[model samples]
Structure formats: structure tokens, C-alpha cells
Target chain A: SAVISQKPSRDICQRGTSLTIQCQVDSQVTMMFWYRQQPGQSLTLIATANQGSEATYESGFVIDKFPISRPNLTFSTLTVSNMSPEDSSIYLCSVTGGSEAFFGQGTRLTVV
Target chain B: AQSVSQHNHHVILSEAASLELGCNYSYGGTVNLFWYVQYPGQHLQLLLKYFSGDPLVKGIKGFEAEFIKSKFSFNLRKPSVQWSDTAEYFCAVKPGGSYIPTFGRGTSLIVHP
Candidate 1:
């Protein structure tokens, strides 16, 4: 399993503000996945990032609302742009180890 | 593309009772199945997994699951429950030759002592 460190562990931001969450891995990985777990909802994939390439956003997500930057193999960032209360959720970072996935500690964000 | 379904959204169990959490996936090709548990405030951990060969596989902490290919189900089971078993369990499926997994909506289990 990979050791992933994500921050801010939690934050309460005002509406229309942006928050950047960082995910650092212990070792180099080819791809990193970003997920959002809304209140009482399943984990939804926000985007998939591969080093040096553009991040692939999911069906309902876009580069404007959720822009991702993957500068290297072990690091990536997801920034929530112009957030609203509806954006309140626990955002998670995950990487595949062997055939299974390992997750980060997660960032709990609250937009008010 | 693959998707997973967890029928029970929330489950309440008493200590020493048997447990079963249903997990079914939609895919016609080969797949890898897994069960993950998230204790309150803890990271999601792999409970068990099935790749091939054995249809039933055991995982850490007395958790087991059986994969029925025909039904496209991999249900989790435990002979007895403990208070410590109270957590959110998620069933995931990764199509063969792919690393990305599709996660179920998770079943939140509450075990009273």
C-alpha cells in the first residue's frame, strides 16, 4: 500500500472561494484518482490524473469547476473553484497498489 | 465500464449475530472483486478480494466473501459480530486489465454490544 498524505485535513470556506487540496504519495505511481463522497452518497470519481498529461474529468465534472494538476508521478492537486455549499463533501485521493486501491486520509471540506 | 451495487444501505446487528452484506456488479467480462471497510474516522482498508481459482476468500479480522460468477455477486459474511466491526463497508469491482475500480454506495454497519 502507498502512504498518501492529503491536506488541509479539513477546511470551512466561504462560497465562491477556492480551496486546493494536495495529495503526496510515498512512492511514484503512474496515476492518481480523485474522489468525492457527498453526504450520504457513494464515492464519485472526480478525475484521473496521469503525470505530465491533462487530467481526465468524469462525466459530470469539468476542468473549470474542478481543475486538476499532476506535475509529477507522486504529487497532484485538486482545486475546487468558485465553490458553493453543494460542494461540501469529503474529497479523497487514491492510488492503485498491485490490483487494489489505497486511499489517503481525505479532506473534509465545508462551503458555507 | 463496470458498476457495483450494494443493496443494504444501513444494517444494524447485535453482538454474536451472523452477518451478510450483498454486493452485485454489472459486467460481462472477467473482473476482480474486493471488499473494503472504513471504521469511523479511519482510512478504507481491504477486507478481502477474489481474483480467480477460489470462489470464497477470507480476509483479515474474520471477514469472508464468496464470488458467484453466474449471479455477478460477491457478498461479505461474518459468523459473529463485535462492536469493533461497526463501520462502513464498500464493495468494489475492477474489470480485468484495468486498475480503476468502481465502488458501491457502501453499507454502514452498526453493531451494538
Candidate 2:
């Protein structure tokens, strides 16, 4: 399993602000997945980032609202733009290790 | 569209009680199944996985799961439960050759000591 590190473990931001969460994996991975877990809700995939290409957003996610950047194989960043209270959730980054997926310590965001 | 379903939303059990959390996936072809557990204040960890061979697969911490192809079910089971087993369990599935996995709404298990 790859060791994943996420920065800004917890944060509080006001409405209309933007916050960027960073994920770094010890080893290079082919696919990096971003997921959101609302309070008491299931994990919903936000996007899939592959190095050197544009990120693919899920059904309800968009490029403008949740922009992603994967500059290298081991690093990816997800930015929540124009945040609102509804955007408050735990954001997690995951990578496929063999057939299993390993996740990072999630970023808990609270929008006021 | 592929989807994973976990029938139990919340389960309460006493120590040494048997556990069986039901999970079902909607897919026609070969699929990879997994069970992940998230302890309080911790990240999700893989409990067990069933890809091929041996419908019954055992994982860390004495946990296991059986994959029933005809029933389209991959249910997690444990002969006995402990306080440490109290956590949220999620079932995920990925169709063969697919990189993305669909996760079910987790089942929260609470075990009394």
C-alpha cells in the first residue's frame, strides 16, 4: 500500500472563500481519485485525476467548482472554489494499490 | 451504471455475537468486490477482497466475506464481534477492466462490550 499524505487536515472557511487540499503519495500511482463524504452520507466520487491530462469530474461535480491539478504522478491538488456551507464535508484522496484502494487521512472542511 | 448496495444502515451487537452485513452489487460481468472499514477518527482500511477463486476470502483481523455470484451478493461475516469491530463498513465493486469503483452507503456497526 502507498502512503498518502494530505495537508490541512481540518479547516474552517467562510462562505465564498476557496480552499485547496493537497495530496501526496510516497510512490507514483496511475490514477488518483477524489471523493467527498458529507456528514452521515456515503462516499461520492468527485473526480479522477491522471497525470498530464485534465481531470474528469463526476456527474454532479464540475471543473469550475472543484478544479483539480495533477502536476506529477505522486502529487495532486483539489481546490474548492466559491465555497458554501453545503460544501462542508470530508474530502479524501485515494489511489489504487494493486486491486485494492488506499485512502489518505481526509481533509475535514467546515464552511461558515 | 454500476451501483453497490448495503442493506443494513445501522447494526448493534454485543461482544461475541455473530455478524453478517449484506452487500449487493449490480453488474453483469466479472467484478472485483471489497470490504472496507473506517474506525472512528481513522481512514478507511481494506478488510477483505474477492477477485477470483475461493468464494470465501479471509482478511486481516479475523474478518471474512463470501461472494455469491448467482445472488450477486458479497456479504461480510465474522463469527464473533468485539468492541474494536465497532465501525462503519463500506462495500465497493468495480467491473472488470474498470478503474473506478462504486461504493455503497456504509453500514455502521456498534458492538457493546
Candidate 3:
């Protein structure tokens, strides 16, 4: 399993402020996934990040709102641009290792 | 497109009670099933998975799930419950050969001692 370190674990930001969450993996992985869990809702895939390429965003997500950067195989970042209260949710970074997917301790974002 | 469904939104049980949570998926092809648990203040952890072979698979913490291919269901079960077992459970399915996994609305389990 890959050990994924994500931060900041919890944060409070103004509605118009942007916040960037970083994910670092202990081992190199081919792909990294970003997911969002809204309060009282299920996990939804935000995008799939691959090294050396642009991220593929999901239907309701966009690059301008949720920009992603995958500089290498072991590190990636997700930036919530122009925050809103609806953007407040738990963001998780995951990597597939072997047959299982390992997750990081999610970043809990709160936009005031 | 693939989607997962978990029948129960919330379940409450007494310690030592039997437990079962229903999960279903909609996909046209073969899939890999997974059950993940999130304890309070903890990250999601894999409880079990079913890729192929046996339809019945056991996972960590005395948890198990059965995959019924014909029914498109993978229901999680535990013979008995413990207070420490309280957590939220999610069922995810990835179509065979696909990199994306679709997750179900989680089921919140509350086990009272």
C-alpha cells in the first residue's frame, strides 16, 4: 500500500479565497485520484491526475474551479480556486497499489 | 456509465447483533467490488474486495461480503456487532479494466454496547 500524506488536514477560508491541498506519496504511482465527500453524501471523483499530463476532470468539475497539478509520480496538488461554501468538503487523495486503493487522511475544507 | 447504490442510509444495532448492508451496482460489464470503512476521525480502510473466483469474500475485522453476479449485488455482513464497529461503510465498483471506481452513498452504522 502507498502511504499518502495530505495537508492541511483541516482549514477555514473565506468564500472568495482559494486553498491548495498537497498530496505526497511514499512510492511512485502511475495514477492518482481526487475525490470529494460532501457533508452527508457519498464520495465523488473530482479528477484523475497522471504524471506529465493534464488532469481529467469529472462531469461537474472543471479546471478553473479545481485545478490539479501532477508534477511527478509521487506528488500532486489540488487547488480550490475561488472558494464557496459549497466547495467545503472533505477532499481525499488516493492511489491504486496492487489490487487495492489506499487513501490519505482527507483534507477537511470549510469555506466561510 | 457506472453507479453504486447502498440501500440503508443509517443502521442501528445492539452489540452482538447480526449485521447486513445491501449494495447494488449498475454496469454493463464485469466489475471489481469493494467495501471500505471509515471509523470516526480515521481515513477510509478497505474491508474486503471481490475481483474473481469466490463469490464470498472475507475481509479485516471479521467482516465479509457476498457478490451475486446475477443480481448485481454485493452485500456486507457480520455475524455479530461490537461497539467499536460503529462507522460509515461505502461500497465501490469499478468496471473490469477501468481505472475509475464508482462509490455508493455510504451507510452509517451505529453499534451500541
Candidate 2 residue pairs in clash (backbone atoms < 3 Å): none
Q: Model 2, residue B55: what's the lDDT?
A: 100
Query: Can you tell me which runs of candidate 2 are displaced by over 4 Å?
Result: none
- Give me the TM-scores of chain B across the candidates: 0.99, 0.98, 0.98
Per model, state how many residue pairs clash. 0, 0, 0
lDDT of 3 by residue, A46-77 (tens): 99999999999999999999999999999999
Per-residue lDDT of B1-113 in model 2, one digit per residue for the tens? 98898999999999999999999999999999999999998889999999999999999889999999999999999999999999999999999998888899899999999
Question: In what order do the candidates fall by DockQ, top score first?
Answer: 3, 2, 1
Compared with the real two-chain complex, what DockQ does model 3 have?
0.78
Report model 2's TM-score to 2 decimal places: 0.97
Task: Looking at model 3, give its docking quality level.
Answer: medium
C-alpha lDDT values of all predictions: 0.95, 0.95, 0.95
What is the lDDT for A26 in model 2?
99
Q: Which DockQ-derived CAPRI band holds candidate 1?
A: medium
Please list the residue runs of candidate 3 whose C-alpha ends up more than 4 Å from where it truly belongs after superposition. Answer: none
